[model samples]
Target: MATDHDIPSPCPSLRDRKKAATRAAILDHAERLFEERGYDQVTGAEIADAANISVKTLFVYFRSKEDLAFADTWLIDAVVDTLSRRPSGTSHAQAVGEVLNQALRTLNPDSGGLDAFHRGFGESEALRSRLLRMWADYEDAIATVLAREASLPAPDPAIRLAATQLIGIIRSCTSDEVREYVSGFPGEETDALRGWIRQAVEQVDNGLTRFLDRTSQSPGI
Candidate 1:
């Protein structure tokens, strides 16, 4: 007899498929328009028209134009999920690296998706502000995970600093400056960037491990 766990899950319903397709179409049209012109120049209504959807429907899919442009909530959730369930022996940095590596592999560097984002970032204060808020959220999430794993009363300075440093490394690597510089390379050089980021993370991991060991052995932790 087949157990509950042995049975395959049901596929998505037609409504779910249509909703997902609509969302994807909105993103596709929005990105293309943003890239061709500038993010600031493209209106949400224009995006809706381009996607062959009503402006009202566009709002249903995405709350705002900024929301449409910076839609990576899945990545944030994935990071938290991975950190929460990582093996006992795996370092926090290692778990983060695993998620990042998978994301990088799936990314198409030549797609120019990030071009508009970076350009808008440089041109618009709103974008720069949004970017900072996004990074802060990532830092806070990391710090929370670190605190939870350590069973700390709260996120201490060391834990917060370590989380900041890890996110900083990621932010620096993905900065508009690095992207422009890497654009000159023969290929996308994703491997080179990935290797460099890994080394940085590993170094931080080693330092964090040593610090934790020392603090744990001290009279007052």
Candidate 2:
């Protein structure tokens, strides 16, 4: 991809500038095409055409139509990095909060070119189903990493269950908050939504604590 000469200010580094340009071009076209035909109806070949790149190059950037699932999606790496950057004494659940909040905030309702993307996603059952699958994938990855950090054995079923609950709570809470805001409810409604999220996080911690406590008291796993 060519440099983003349209921007008045120069990017800090040429490498970053080029990479951003390529990523932006691909997403711009992807979003447009996705909005045009509903996500499932759009093809990668169409995306490549819209982005003025080869299909191979487009595939190099994005693996699937499902990738257009999120606007400027950076969940996997960004969430991991966010968790890693938390200061000492930040609880694991709070670290999770920071990761999710940082990831979602970058795509606020006012973001340009995103309104259509949100409309497409919100109105399409196919897109919603695909998002659920992606969410499951994300939760599984998070659970695997959490298991490693907590020194649990591979394929830790407990970690997976906790991760599933966490993911479910997050999705439900966020959706409820969005519903409240759209309905022009008071800020307190959103506050309640957050309270529920905090409760969900606390429940995970409590469950983990109980598990460790039981293991300590027991003779074997």
Q: Give each model's whole-structure lDDT.
A: 0.74, 0.61
Off by over 4 Å in 1: 1-21, 112-122, 180-184, 210-221
Highest-lDDT candidate: 1
Query: In every candidate, how many clashes are there?
Result: 0, 0
Which run of 10 residues does model 1 get worst, by summed lDDT? 113-122
Give the local distance difference test score of model 2.
0.61
- Superposed model 2: Cα runs more than 4 Å off: 1-23, 32-46, 54-63, 70-73, 84-88, 103-119, 123-125, 173-196, 202-208, 212-221
Model 2 residue 163 distance off true place after TM-score fit, in angstroms: 1.8
Per-candidate TM-scores read: 0.74, 0.63
